[model samples]
Target: MFRAIGNEELGRGTLGHSLHMLLAEDPDFPSSTRSAVDELMRQSELDCAVRAIIIAVTSAQNPHDELEHVLRSHPALLESEWMCDIRATLREFGCFSLY
Candidate 1:
C-alpha cells in the first residue's frame, strides 16, 4: 500500500491523501500498519530536515511544541547541518520564534 501510494503512475496524488483514504476505509487496519507507514514517512523525510522543520512549524498551532516533538522523535537530527540550515531559513522567514 505504501508503494502504491508512492507510485507516480497511480495518479493517487500525495501519499498523505492516499493514506487518509485507506485509514477512512480500512476498518481492519492495525496499529502496526500505521506505525510502519509512519516509519517509512519519517525515513523519507530524514534527508530533508528543512522540509520536516517547515512542516512542523507551519502545521501546528504551537510551532514550539511541534518542533520540540520533532526533535524528541528524531534526536539524530538535533545537531545535523540540515537542522542548522532549517533554523536559519525559519529565522529568515520570521518563524524563529517557533524554536
Candidate 2:
C-alpha cells in the first residue's frame, strides 16, 4: 500500500487521521485489533492518494522527481501498481528518456 502511495506520489496526512477517527468512532464496526490495524493501513493508502495533488502542488520538485524520491525513501512503494504507473508516466514525459 505504501508502494502505491509512493508511486502515485501521494502524501500521508489529515485525511488518514480523519478516516481513522471516523472508523474508531463507529460503534457497530466489528474486527479484531489486528484487523483494525490492517484497515488503517488501507485507509492510509487511500489517504495518500487523496493527498497526492496537494503534495504535488506544495513541493518545488518536479513530478517525476517527487515520485522517485517517495518510492526510494519508502521501500514498500516499490511493490505497488502505483510504482509501475509512475515509471510509465516518467517515461512518457521523458523524465528518464534516453534520447
Q: Write the per-residue lDDT of candidate 1 for residues 2-81, one digit (tens) a residue.
A: 44432232223555344544554545433333344347457764444433344335434555555555667667665667
Off by over 4 Å in 1: 1-45, 85-99
> What does candidate 1 score on TM?
0.39
In angstroms, how far off is 79's CA in candidate 1? 3.6
Q: Residues 56-83, candidate 2, lDDT per residue (tens digit)?
A: 3133136576555545545454555645
- lDDT, candidate 2, at 9: 34
Best by TM-score: 1
**Model 1, CA-based lDDT:** 0.48
Q: Which 10 successive residues of model 1 have the least lDDT summed? A: 3-12
